[model samples]
Target: MNTQLQVKNNTNELHHILTRLENESTRKEDLIIPARNLMFHEDGFIYDRSSNKIDGYVLNEWATGQFAQKTNIPSKYFRQCPPELKAVNANHWIKELSSDEDWMLRTMRSRDGSPGVVRGIMSDKYVPFDDIEILNILDDVLAKFNKDYEIEMWNRGDTGCHLRVTFPDLTTSVGKLTNGAPDIHRVGFHMMNSEVGKSSIRITPMVYRMICTNGLMGWDTNGDVFQQRHIYLNHDEISNRVTGAIGKALKLGDNMINDLLKAKETEIENPYDVIDQIAKDNKYSQKLTGIIHESFDRERGNTAFHVVQALTLASQTLNADSRTEMERKASQVLNKLVVGL
Candidate 1:
């Protein structure tokens, strides 16, 4: 006997495939980040979301607003910024010009027939640095440490430019408490412009979370960063400074490796205790505390390494200044856990 084969509906199959393709093509959500609002104060200063004040003196409201617009920070934040945020002083906003005998200012009649004192000329020259030049400098410096160094990401906007370079050769993985859960370390360079209204380059020592690929950048030591002024464009000086910074960073990285190894060996049955201690010892924000708790809960085991990783991930969510403070506190907490060991 001969059997007849039945064919499925070709039209229906084609329609289903087309629908799936369409869904895949339009799945991405459009995300828009708003510009930061910088506040301008009557006393001539700008402030971001922090309580600290920027060291800029505005001679008039028009100048202050111009500075605020240029800086792009909210007016409220700048006005309410606290004194602690104030640096001793900075000439970042000020510009110097050479005296030229040929240049002369046109005569201006003062309002109300009164003579006004000359306030001097505003600077017209603003120094510019090529982003590529800065990256080349980083490339030269990072190559000495790791030949495999490569730029992982690049971001730029009104805030300024940011380049993240990764060093695959200088990585470390350690896990003694949980045999399968090894925390990985990836060293890199995070070079950027307009970091706190100044150009800077730094050794970005970030840890990789085993579960999630979050680059925990809460451990940027003071010794790792080098800030430079645009006006002082000295390649030799910058190269020398970068060389010294790299040496210090290598030493810091070695110490971190040792500390992480110790952390892996140290056991903690209840990781929440560490989180609680950290929260109490250092007035951590609710958001930071919440992230820490989540990190501990998500971690597979109770170990000092996991606790440190958790805290590190939490610190990344903080604002620029707060992240630095949290990283220092986390370091202190981790150190306390393995003081003798």
Candidate 2:
């Protein structure tokens, strides 16, 4: 007797097949993991997510993001890279095949935005030096390249060291290089800010560099291969200070001008109050009284110029003393306004 074979379509069978396919794909193809999970070996090779595989390692998205952030590279470009490929490409070790460190030194010096080319000399016989010592050597080599720019070190996450150079123009540029390697890459921007009425402008600049090196064990690195710098202006604070200065200058009026001069040695809360008291005691004109009242009203948006214009129009029908006082106050306020700007 022959037996017939039956096909099973059970939920458990379907789930098992799907899980197997996922595992196979992940194992065969490059698996993209978060930067936080990455662990670097002593030889400079990175550990893959699966302990069994050496090639399937995680990449540094945060380092790449830091590069994008400092260089002002568009977010669209970073997002364009495949998530797995981005991780691998960003975190890969830089292996220097050539015995000549000239290429690396020339690249860093030329990009430093300094006056001349900077040359690097090998201090020790070892191919892979300590990351900290290498950074110090790079700093010394680049220092002669740009005397006007200030160079500093930056560390982005666990990736590597960043060489930041600030220029006199208030602009900064960062050089991104692997922490312990000599490979160099760069990125950054310029920024400017100014008060609405101020004559001066504040500027800031940034740059980036990336470094990598090869040796017997593999590639080792130290600093950030990416970096950024920016300048900020407090516009609201400037405006407030200007407004206060203008208001203080307006309180210098004839009725209180003498009193103010007399009490200039003393600190008075409201200068306008001194003027108002004098106007009431001397039976000042209604137009003058109205002008003083209007000037003192903090709620009104009337600038000193507007107050003067109104006073001038009403002065034609008022006494000489009141007219002269309004004209004097208006002139003083106008001068203050122009100078404040």
Candidate 3:
């Protein structure tokens, strides 16, 4: 079966996948600094040294929130403070309250409105298990997946990434295609990671629609195929864990197929209601909620499968992290209706 490239994320189109990842790896600079050495400046965080100060380390949204939490202050209140007040609050807390242990500040060169952005602040023990390194480990597990599997979809951004690869031999038929052919859904994996402390490295099952290039990633009641936080894990241990996880994912293909088949048969009396509720319950932004409605209208299918497909289709244009979240939510919608699959 030919793998369909969804949206603009084809691996070949990206010049070279590993090269792109290597570029990301190069842009990062991780520093381990004592909490007491930290201070906040106007619109940035500072490394306060009397003789030689490093002040360009601006806190990105995530890092700012983290810093606020660390200082025992609410992020909203912290951001609203005057520049001098912010510094005072930050310095006072860092000096008086913080422990002596070193903290890791994950930073990137200033870009996209963030100047020398500290994307994450974590304990010094936080392992730097980023995407490039993890994929290298997978190379050993799946023979680099060069001969059999293909990287059909890719989403990359400063926040995180989701890589979707297709498994040709593990497809199952579901629904009907636009060309009067059986709709084929293939089993695959959605490898997700966050270098900026957004999420743990995770592998979830993927359901890809060959007909319309729609794909949804999800966790069943069983959860991810693999999930490991970037903490206290040595290289050898993570490698062993990844090898076992991928092996298990390949063998466990039937659940996703069964779910899609059931979704195809299950009709929703009111998709909009369900969609609206799910989006609201999940605290989806107004923009994302609108996308789902538009996708549903365009697809014009009444079955639960169609609703899920609409969500996945809508997700195609989102940023990597948002797309992953949207697809995960779509899968939950399908799962809620026909669970055992």
- Ordered from best to worst TM-score, the candidate numbers read 3, 1, 2
lDDT of 3 by residue, 1-341 (tens): 01123443333443366676687667678888777877667554576554233466777677878889877888999888887888888888887764666788887775475556678888888888887887777666666444366676766665677777777777778867656788888877778887767889998877778877777776667888889887886888888888777666665555767777878788899889988888899887898889889988887688888788888988877766777787887887887877834
TM-score of each: 0.53, 0.16, 0.82
How big is the positional error of residue 106 in model 2, measured in Å on the Cα after superposition?
29
Which of the numbered candidates is closest to the native, going by highest lDDT?
3
Best-matching candidate per TM-score? 3
Clash pairs for candidate 1: 37-73, 37-74, 38-73, 38-74, 39-74, 39-75, 51-82, 52-85
Q: Please rank every candidate by lDDT, starting with the best.
A: 3, 1, 2
Model 1 CA lDDT for position 340:
44
Q: State how far residue 281 of model 3 sits from its true place (Å).
A: 3.7
In candidate 2 the C-alpha lDDT for residue 252 amounts to 25
Please write out the lDDT profile of model 2 over residues 183-274, one tens digit for every residue: 22222211111111111221112222121110000000221111111123243443343333222222222222232122223333454554
What TM-score does candidate 1 reach?
A: 0.53
Task: State each candidate's clash count.
Answer: 8, 42, 1
True-structure Cα RMSD, model 1 = 17.3
What's the distance in Å from true for residue 69, model 2?
28
C-alpha lDDT of all candidate models, in order: 0.48, 0.30, 0.75
What's the distance in Å from true for residue 314, model 2?
56
